[model samples]
Target: MDTHEWQKSSYCQEGEACLHVAAVTTAETVHLTESADPAHSILSTTPAAFGALLRVLRDDDRG
Candidate 1:
């Protein structure tokens, strides 16, 4: 597996283990995982798809 510079979510509380995200250098895929159990679960998606997901989530928050 390729090593990535994972970044924790800013929305996470201080000292709380929460969502982390990283971009794959070899491809257009982005990787998402939880800081508390990174080895147990991970999600991979393309940047475009991830962007669409975020847009939908934002829209939902407004509705």
Candidate 2:
């Protein structure tokens, strides 16, 4: 697999790591990993699934 350019959220404070996300060039999936332990494991999902997750989180935040 090709190396991906992972990006952390701007909301992350300095020295305080959070989830990092990257797009897979070979597939229509997004890769996710914790910044503090990137070598351990990664979560892969479709863009639609990721969007749904984000939407749910955002809706929950407003309630």
Candidate 3:
């Protein structure tokens, strides 16, 4: 709800379009959205699932 403090991805280049994410501790969920479209939609996932996603993405970039 009101506690969503969205943060831009560190890998994002200087621009209006990029990934933004937030963690809602009360719900134990992670939230994701696009900076350029924050109002249009949002994606929510559990912390464990979000961690798995980051690991996979990191591994893909390393390969």
The estimated TM-scores of all candidates read 0.77, 0.78, 0.86
lDDT of 3 by residue, 1-63 (tens): 245898889999998888988998999999998878757488899999999999999999999
Please give the ranking of all candidate structures by lDDT, highest first, separated by commas.
3, 1, 2
Best by TM-score: 3
- Better candidate number, 1 or 2, judged by lDDT: 1
lDDT of 1 by residue, 1-63 (tens): 247888877778876478888988689888988877746478999999888988998899899
Error of 3 at 45 (Å): 0.6
Q: Which pairs of residues collide in candidate 2?
A: none
Model 2 TM-score relative to the real fold:
0.78
Give the worst 10-residue stretch by lDDT in candidate 3.
Answer: 33-42
Candidate lDDT (C-alpha), each? 0.81, 0.81, 0.87
- Clashing residue pairs for model 1: none
- Candidate 1 vs 2: which has more TM-score: 2
Ranking by TM-score: 3, 2, 1
C-alpha lDDT (0 to 100) for residue 11 of candidate 3? 95
lDDT of 1 at 51: 89
